[model samples]
Target: MNVVEVKGTELEDAFQIRREVFVEEQGVPLQDEFDGYDESGAAARHILVYYEDQPAATGRLRWLGDTAKLERICVRAAMRKFGLGSVVVKSLEKIAQEEGFCKAKIHAQTQAQNFYERLGYRQTSEEFMEDGISHIVMERTI
Candidate 1:
């Protein structure tokens, strides 16, 4: 497994994984699944994870004041069994730390609350609807 910072043509690999997992599988609207944060000049870093040279997962990290917001994290259905989701989160956390961020946050889908908890994140807000799915804010020190 390998994770790399990507942009330009290589960034398309990350978008493809997101479309497969978020837009196609999760029913998230195409318009909501993407936004200005994905642009090349946006204040965000995107990462693509590869398993045996195939893109398996992707995530985005955006700095918001003192916190690093981890977003759009998803793994291809076929790659879910390999624990790539944790890898994606940890990689993003590492990047945040490297960038001088001391805190990290995620708006986690309720279905994955336990997953984030297992990685040391604690729920910081009540469940709320986001993109029509129940989600809660989670935070942890990076």
Candidate 2:
């Protein structure tokens, strides 16, 4: 498996992975699944993970002041057991730290809270609704 920074037309692969996991599988609205931040020239840095040359996971990094916001993290269901999710998060964290950010945050789905916790993120907020799903804010210093 390998992670690559993708932009322009290359972003299509990332979007496909997100659509499969977040839209088709999770029921997120098409409009909500995509946003202006995905467009070219946006400040966000998108990452794609490929296993055997096939896209397996994707996420993006955006800055919120001094904090790195990790968003759209999703792994292909079949690839979940391969730890691609962790690879995506670690890659984003590494990118954020290299860019001078000391903190990173994610709005983690309630069901996946434990996964993030295992990675050293601690919950900082009560459960809340985001895009019609239960989620909570998690933070970690990278």
- For TM-score, the strongest prediction is 2
What 10-residue stretch in candidate 1 is worst by lDDT?
4-13
TM-score of 2: 0.99
Off by over 4 Å in 2: none
For each candidate, the alpha-carbon lDDT, in order, equals: 0.95, 0.96
Cα error of candidate 1 at position 113, Å: 0.3
Residue-level error in angstroms, candidate 2, position 39: 0.2
**For model 2, how does the per-residue alpha-carbon lDDT over 8-113 read when each residue is reduced to its tens digit?**
9999999999999999999999999999999999999999999998999999999999999999999999999999999999999999999999999999999999
**Candidate 2 lDDT for residue 136:** 99
- Number of backbone collisions per candidate: 0, 0
The residue-level lDDT of candidate 2 at 120 comes to 91
The residue ranges of model 1 lying beyond 4 angstroms of the native Cα positions read none
